[model samples]
Target: MTNHIVERASARLNESTLLEMFWGMLLSRRLDERAWALHRQGKIHFHISGMGHEAAQVGTAFALNRGVDYIHPYYRDLALSLAVGITPTDFMMSLFGRKDEYSSGGRQMPSHFSSKDKHIISGSSPVATQVPQAAGLAFAIQYRQKCGLVDPNDTSQPRLALACLGEGSTSQGEWHEGMNWAGVHKLPFICLVQNNIYAISVPLESQMAVANVADRATAYGVAGVVVDGNDVLAVYDVMVQAVQRAYSGGGATLVEAKTYRPVPHSSDDDDRSYRSREEVAEWKKKDPIMRFQNSLLEDGILNDSLLHDYESRARAEVDKAQADAEAAPLPDAEEVFGSVYAPLEEQP
Candidate 1:
């Protein structure tokens, strides 16, 4: 089904880049499985699986200029974080809540990814807060350009901010407010909503009256698009266009990627309580990772041996990360308030 899609993508991206995307998706899946195992063993407090959304996350991550554009990702963006350069070791340290964890120094929970070097802003526990923050970042980029702080003539440098959220967050006022502001200001922002059919136990039909989340973008006067989230190449193409528009001074874009959450909302939630087993089974047949791999094999870009090698490497990396993280030290109790506020000496 996706052979033609892969062929089209090959026209725009090389085989190496496609393989990198596959590796990222595979690594994300392995890491998510590891996190779930750690939680079940009582080694971690909570776990949010990003199993089905890896295609969308990784596809969009590769579309952006990784160290340049700011990313305000929701908690489910495990694949996105990894594609943007966050290592498996970083994720393991975060899961183990080690003192040296890059995201928050062990303050934030697992899956709440952040990295200063990668330009991934720290996210809050509250949903949709990153929407406004992303808008602000985009505005700042434009402001700097106007103030001559950034070289306006540098066409190679694209200043944009990407904010990702679940479909449920589209109901939040922050989502609307931030998107509206970005539209009104013509900010370099790309708002991506991963529609996974359900928000916790609540289904999409109950959340909004619109057919698609991107429909809301119409009210904000921004370009709205919907894509097949399971098709990594399709997602990459859409994101490339959106990023180009933003870089060329076009207004914000609202992209709704139709995906599925193969697992429950979190380890604590029971998916069986609300959804049917058959429904999940149906979606499993469309697993993005499997689909992408099949497409690569059909196009002769990948083979069984290469796939096996990549999967083995990914599993080994995850195992090493987990072992290293387990041995790492925890944050000291005395420094509980360390990152919360600045010390008086550094206030000035």
Candidate 2:
């Protein structure tokens, strides 16, 4: 049997792709910044920064089908959600817990993003739960010979489910269960482990034996590879192959992206209790936004002026989105009972 060779290359991104990636990263970053501000201002209950994971999210999104494919994204994957047709307004509304919020019926706290219209499943608060759900959704598609939540004969092609998680979630039973099932069934799914080296407060050394979570794929008889998660183009290339492999019946692939989390786990947690200032400083050297911007500049795709312009635009847009969200009316108290399973009388 021949082995597959999908190299994780760190080459220049196409000029257009570089611009698009930069713009996307800027939007994701600005959104996080404003969301955090909202939390501080008492406008939002909680906030999570997708800061360091922007490369992994946006790059992965560029590699998959947006409206056609399904994405079982975790809370930290705001960039992925945005890239897959989730408007800034939608995300802001979700963050503000307003009536316009599509994911939660205005009930879920901020960061739990979803879009039924785009087939991006609403992520749960339970850790690692989405891993198995993604594989299960993929298996159902193959079993029914069609896509779920849509007509079977749409000819949109059988979409793959890309589920991402924090490296810490890999310690859970659901991770192994999802990987094993995908391997056994040759399901069209991709499990991406974002190894940011901290599970809220627990360090990576305490979580897994291997340096890379990708190494664990050996147990499931699947291909595993690690890429520079801070390198957007590199992540993009790997995701491209992973998505193509799954769509072409090559089965599941596990990509362990080595990244860092710039902010504390959430608004409530203080990272200083567990991590050293020196450690955070070290990780800052690998900042995804800076690295990706350098990649673009070195490739002659962008200059400092262009980068600044894009970021300014993104920041302004984020401000507008936040303002719109704050101005939108909150969901009425009784409306909470609306979307949950409908009325008992309506059930057959």
Tens digits of per-residue lDDT for model 2, 291-344: 878877897788989978897889788878888888999989888568657678
Error of 1 at 77 (Å): 0.3
Q: How many residue pairs of model 1 clash at the backbone?
A: 0
| Regions more than 4 Å wrong, model 2 | 1-13, 146-155, 342-348
User: lDDT at 271 for candidate 2?
Assistant: 98
**Local error of candidate 1 at 284, Å?**
0.4
- Measured against the true structure, the TM-scores of the candidates, in listed sequence, are 0.95, 0.92
lDDT of 1 by residue, 1-348 (tens): 011222444267889999999999999999999898889999898898889999999889888898679999999999999999889999999988898798988988888988877889999879999998999999998998988988855755548999999998888999989998998999999999999999999999999998999877778888888989988988888788788778888878898899999999999999999999999999999999999999999999999999989988998999999999999999998767786766799966
- Candidate 2 backbone overlaps, count: 0
Once fitted onto the true fold, the runs of candidate 1 whose alpha carbons sit more than 4 angstroms away are 1-10, 153-158, 343-348
Q: List the residue pairs that clash in candidate 1.
A: none
